[model samples]
Target: MIDEPEPRRQTPQELRGLVGSANIPTLLMVIYQVTRDERWLRPPYLPTRSKGLGDHDSGGLPEPVQEEIRAAGVRALLDLQDGRAPAIALPDPEQTRRMLEACVGEPVDRSYGEMFAREFRRRAGADDGPARPVRGGSDLRVLVIGAGVSGIIAAHRLERMGVSYLVVDKHDAPGGNWLDNRYPGAGVDTPSHLYSFSFAPRDWTQHFELRGELERYFADTFDRIGARPRTRFGTEVVRAEFDEGRQLWDVELRDSDGLRESISVNAIVSAVGILNRPFVPALPGLELFGGPSFHSSEWNDDLDVTGKRVAVIGSGASAMQIVPAIAPSVRGLTVFQRTPPWVAPFEKFQQPIDPGARYLLRTFPLYRTWYWLKLYWQFGDKVLDALRKDPDWPHPERAVNARNDGHREFFTQYIRDELAGREDLFGKVVPDYPPFGKRILLDNGWYRALCRPNVELVNEAVTSVVEGGVVSSSGAVHEADVLVWATGFTASRFVSSLEIIGRDGQSLREAWDDDDARAYLGVTVPGFPNLFLLGGPNSFPGSGSFMHFMEVQMRYVGRLLTCMFDLDIRAIDVRKDVFDEYAELVDRTSATTVWTHPGTDTFFRNSRGRLVFVSPFRNVEYWTRAQSAGLEDYEIVAAP
Candidate 1:
């Protein structure tokens, strides 16, 4: 008898999931490296003495390069939202390329092109075959702009559905926020395990993941789903026009090579998230500061800060992470705070996943699914009730209303308990805003860093950046050798920097006008029929993993593709009435949540003082709403 195929022997590392190609593993390594998570394999991915993001120039640029840098910085100081400054001149492009090559090793080539082409032919709707008639005039056409998480997810879903789609990204790759924000402590606030796709659960070694790991996750996502072939790297969507006459979208793309190309598609999806653009605060004498300074999102990686005295502005999530991560290394750290933040107690924020749990998750995907589900409800949906305004509860300043008041007391006690002995810091750390009013920051050594002897948390708002340091409005000048602005991205305004035009010569900026950024089910717009949006307004989840929400939107887009196939519709635009109705529902729901609490300031609200980005409903409600599209929700156009 032929010997039965020998049972596959799994490596020890494989069994432990220490080695893998998934996103979470890399994320685990990153968190472990940065935070020294004892549970993970010791010594995470560490680069030998390199420039961190927001590093200032150390007088090493040529005259021309230096001039360009000065010009960009001056322009940014003048107008925060004008455009992204060009990357500072590197140590010669070829030399930098060589260094990168040495670091990552020789590039590995994969045949995604052939894979995508084959899958397209095999799964393309009914008209895939040579004899099949072109019922809708073209075979499986889709357009996706923005190469961030949402963009990647949309492309993956389209690929899975065998749709012929082009994904355009201004950046070199995916991972939106991850790609853009590369500050010293740049990492995910959520646990890496829960912050990933349901279809691609990873054996992450730690809870919070760092930037490199997140980027790898995006790379692995394309590798897993075979979506790379349909992507145009280093290409930006300058204009997207809706052609009502042909039921198509005309997209004008510009690449790094300076080549301009216009393509037509039956549908368009804007995957560019609101957080892609950096928002630097405007302050007097900001340009006059001769020392190093830059936004947290657009981190400069050449200026060294090993022994420099640092001044960090904006005590938000990024600020919190930046302060703690750089505290141990910097000579002195001065953190500027506009308002104290409510510190929620999360024990696992800086910890690693248990070994037993890792085994179950990696070996059995069901366990992972169950864990994600538990997180979905525990973190995502459950908070909706907690955020509801509690009319009966006491304590107004600590918490605005009742349900909000209850949550505040619960979190305040948690913080009080954590800082039991340190009353001095407790007074400074405890936030006046109700819990969930702003983005609740996880404890990634922020509290512990505050207790450090070298770190100082300043509660005063900054008024100006002098030559030596920053002067607060309270007339205190804190001297520093280097300044780091951990202020976050320009949120609430969708695709503000990019110049995009839809049908009838309508610009996206004109349509949004910095406020009223709404879309149909946070995916489609009425006038821009063929255009779909991924992480558009009202789609951002207030709790849980943003990836979970992205997956839901991806699945929804996939279903739409299925409809395009089954119904043979060339295009479908959300009805204006339907979009308006959805926007009204979103507004009504948001008004009742803690997000609208009068006492707090957050990026979730627009200039009009209206909450435009976050979802007020529970995760299940959103999932159900996005699971399938109603015919009445959209106006479909059929081919003649």
Candidate 2:
């Protein structure tokens, strides 16, 4: 006898556990969406920091009122999950814009709202439809190089579109930079929620997760998407030559066994990201160092440094993370700084997520989406204005303008607060350049690390690596048992290691002579037909989650490929005029930003002092441009 299933229990604890205070605003917004209730749009439920957009302000609400709202939200969530509530229509473009503006505490344009709505719908499993096969596009064979974030995203989209593809990487597995950079304190500075793929959300335990968790996330993402089976590990693409007659790319690959092979594919997606290569400066007597020396990217974990003297070179992002991590353990730690970086304050930079927050993210419907969007607003384009040059302001060197000067003051004050009573460290740590002129680092106890008794902050350039340790420009040799070069990558040299020959046998190196790498929308080039770059020149978002940029670029690439298949086109190249125009626009926009300021010398700029690494446009602007493949922007050639 089949017994009727017992009614599922719904208790207050279960409901309360499903939502957190951080997500209260979002839950209310969703309730408003479903019920059209004006009550959900008011005080305690709504954001309260800056006219209902910034941080959550629950202090104004009585405890009883907050509880009532939570109870209502849980009931709504349960109803929605149990199919008791009718499905609500996706937010209209205007509603989406206003909602995001209210959530972000900043004015957002229509394009941003539309982008957010599309992403929201997609994440909610309410997007247009699942990817269906195109009737005429079965002959496409694409090769994606690198199994990093960009490569994984590109592969996932290609599979969704029902296109045949293969991914190859030099590493044994996925997680490009995460896999390589396993130094003492290697982790992402970006918030974990916002740093991940929008489609594949996880309940992150930390605000800024470490290397292992990130690597696991990437591996899990690759496995979940069934991308691992399509990837060839320990296989590196050495060169790719476009066969103009056949309209295919002949890719040369070398496997782990030192065996070379060639594969012909209809198109190529170069996702070997900017940060793969390690750049160790040619310091005098570098090879003469008698102790163990290594770049932070190529970390030697087996070497023990406890109670040993360790010299860390470069005070960039990596150094900022490493010094704090190793200072307590090492007997003596000397940090060599070429220049001080502008570190922004973050309260939870090193804190883990509360259990209640994790519970809300895991159990509640649309809670993670709302949280991500809120973070996107807070960290995304909000800082863009400060990066732009104010023509009316007189001080361009110390700061870009009054707003940028305010930022400088704020950051300086934070530093002063962190290093209170230690005026000696103040002169050594404060940067002279404008805020956002360089990559802004999150202060993960970096100031506190400097104040440690065992740690010494040397603000002098390293002249050479002596027999025992690093020799500063002041002619003082700082001895150490280990030397860690935290210097960054050759970011401007996009895919420079690979020999890629395009139309008329012109190599990519020759096309980008003197490291003048430029691409249309940072994806397509004039001579490189049917070849797309994932994280190419000018693709780095100046101030936002780079993962968002990757997703946008991948979608654009996917759209381009789908268009090619639909039109029966074999190869597509950006028009030279279009490429030149876009390059000029990029250069012009860059000239008006702080990255191009004369006082700044960062990896963001190329050898010619051009802003080659970072994008000058807003995230929403890039999203709008990358949402579609403009057929007129390229010259499509039919297959022979």
Query: Could you say which candidate leads in TM-score?
Result: 2
Q: For each candidate in turn, give its C-alpha RMSD to the true structure in angstroms.
A: 17.8, 3.5
lDDT of 2 by residue, 570-604 (tens): 88889999899889999999989999999989999
User: What TM-score, over all chains together, does every model reach?
Assistant: 0.77, 0.94
- Candidate 1 RMSD computed on C-alpha atoms after optimal superposition onto the true structure: 17.8
Model 2: CA > 4 A from native: 1-10, 17-21, 42-46, 50-68, 128-130, 638-640
Cα-based lDDT for every prediction: 0.65, 0.81
Model 2 TM-score, 2 decimals: 0.94
Question: In candidate 1, what residue range of length 10 has the lowest lDDT sum?
Answer: 47-56
lDDT of 1 by residue, 286-324 (tens): 987878888887668776778889998888888877887
